[model samples]
Structure formats: C-alpha cells, structure tokens
Target: MASFLALLPRSLTTFLYAVAALLRFYGNIDTTPISKIPLTILQWSFITFILGTAALLANLGLEWNAGNRSRNREIEERNRADQERQRAVSRARIQNRFFLLQTRHQLTPSPETRTALADFLSFLQEYGE
Candidate 1:
C-alpha cells in the first residue's frame, strides 16, 4: 500500500502529461477554429484524471489492507491449531502415565522421567494457553 501510494503522484503526473500531448495534437489540426473550443474540456479532463487516479489509489490501499488482515487471520488460526495439537498430545501422555501409576499402585516415578514429564507438561501449558 505504501509503495502504491508513493507511485500515485508519479502516475498522475504521467497521465496529465499524456492528456496534454493529446490535446496539443488536436489543437495543432487546421480545423475551423481551435480558440472556439471551450477551454473547460481540457480543465475538466485534468480534473477527471486526477479524481480517477485518487480512486484507483484508494482501491489499491483497501485491497492491500484486506489482504494483510486475511493473512494475519490465517496465521492466528494456524497457531491456534498447533497449540491445540500440542495440548492433545500432552494430555494423552499425562493420562497414560497416570494409568501406569495406578496399575502399579505407586506414587513415585523415576527421577529423570518425572523431571522430563514435568518439563514437557510445563511447556505445553505455556504455549497452549
């Protein structure tokens, strides 16, 4: 959007120059009377060109903003989905560990395994929340 806005002035200038060249061409013709043609036509053409260019620039800005918003929405959705997956995996591991502990009727886990599971659960909570 910024880039297009930057180019807008240049584009308008070029369009005005082209219009002037066309008018000059018509003016050069040996028609009945060049002076009689309303100068309003040239003035109106320049005004119309400027208005049209402004509209075009506004449209480009709107589209660019919408596209960026859509991309951000997509990224947010992807992150949410990833977090959900991680939570599901962590829940499953915790349940499995609990089940094994129940079957063995033991409250104690091997130190290394306990530390690893605790760390994994902490990571899941940090990201999934």
Candidate 2:
C-alpha cells in the first residue's frame, strides 16, 4: 500500500499522457508499422516521449548533485585555509612575545623574565603542532 502510494504520482502522470495521446491521434488513417512490429506514429511518439523525459530528468539530477558536491568541497577548503591563517597569526604573536621577554632578560638579567620567555617558547611549540 505504501509503495503503491509512492508511485501514485507517476502512474497518474502516465495515465494522463495516454489520454492526451489518444485524443490527439484518434481516428488516424496511417496505421502502418514503423518497424517489423505494428507500431504507429502516435505510439512511437508516446514511448519516446516517456523514455526521453525520464532520461533527461535523471541526467539533470546527477548534474545538480555533482555541482553541490563541488561547491561543498570548495567551502571546506576555504575554511581550512582560514584556520591555517589564524594559526600563523597566533604563532607570530607568540614569537613576538618571546623576543620581547628575551630582550628584557638580556638588559635586566632577571629570573622572572627568563621564566616568561621559556613559557612563551613552550606555548609556541605546542600551538605549532
């Protein structure tokens, strides 16, 4: 029952197409077969139209999904690049702080300044990883 309902729209569409084809091509005198089998122009048109429309729609869906996947991949790459830039900026700040501490220690020769420089260096190492 669920599956039948799922196919209801397609079945209804096919029925409507059949009705339209019958109305348009009713009382045709050319009943000649296009091939070995007895197939009229109206019948061929109906068959081709149905199959062609299905194929075209399927192709369009595939192309749409492919385009979305490509767009998502580009966004992910941009995010990664932004994160790398942020990390580079943070490392530069740490290096600057370490240099300032080193300069102060050189001038005053204090244990506190030395400890601070060591701490900044350790932080830079951790952040780089």
Candidate 3:
C-alpha cells in the first residue's frame, strides 16, 4: 500500500506531462513568449518564501513567549508556597511561646512566683540577645 501510494504521484505527473505535450502539439501554439512572465513568477516565488519564513518566525516567537510566561507563573506559585510555609512556621513558633508562658504562669502563682517568672523572662531575653 505504501509503495502504491508513493508511485501514484509519479504516475500522475507523467500522465499530465504526456497530456500537456499532446495538447500543445495538436494546438499549434506559438513559440513566442513574454520575457517578463518568468521574472514575475520568480519574484512571486521569492516573496512567498519570505512570507512563509516570516510566519514561521512569528509562530516560534509566540511559542517562546508562551513558554516564558508559563515558567514565570510556576516560579511565582513556588514563591507563594514558600512564603505560606514560612508564615505557618512563624505562627507555630508564636503559639508555642504563648503556651509555654501560660503553663509557667499557671505553675507558679504567688508573689515569689511573679519574681521568678520575671527573672526567667529576663534570662531568656539576655540569652536570646
């Protein structure tokens, strides 16, 4: 099937050429031709090639721009996810600190306990600094 399909165009081309030759022979066509026709056809072919190249370049440019936009969107999404994770971590740390302070206050509930809590907080602050 592939071979037959491949031969089809060659057969068609030969048949058309034979038909054109026969017609031209029978019609007794003049040998004279316009000189500008070939040049015009050549110029038109060149223009067509240029237009095709321009269209291909434009398509490539559009594809490249679309790829860049997709990449940028992915980067932005990753950055957003990272920022959300950082915020979650910060919130967890703050909650942990709050719970720890509450527990310490509950464990020690007298004037001496207050002084102890102040001293502990100061120690923590100094250590942190």
Using lDDT, give the best candidate's number. 2
* Clash pairs detected, candidate 2: none
Give lDDT tens digits, candidate 1, residues 2-118: 888767656765676677556546654533433666555455455556665775676677668879999999999999999999999999999999999775653456786678778
Q: Kindly report which residue stretches of model 2 are placed more than 4 angstroms away from their true locations once superposed.
A: 1-29, 32-39, 109-129
Q: Please list the Cα RMSD from the true structure of every candidate, rounded to 1 decimal place.
A: 13.0, 11.5, 13.8
Report lDDT per candidate. 0.71, 0.73, 0.66
Q: Which wins on TM-score, candidate 1 or candidate 2?
A: 2
Q: Residue 24 error for model 1, in Å?
A: 10
User: Candidates ranked by lDDT, best first?
Assistant: 2, 1, 3
**lDDT of candidate 2 over 1-129, digit per residue (tens):** 966754554665566566546634762756577679787766776675676567556556666876999999999999999999999999999999999997766768588767877898899999968
Better of 1 and 3 by lDDT: 1
In order of listing, the candidates' clash counts read 0, 0, 0
- Tell me the tens digit of each residue's lDDT in model 3 across 9-45: 4455455445445545544443443275543333444
In Å, residue 121's CA in model 1 sits off its true spot by 37
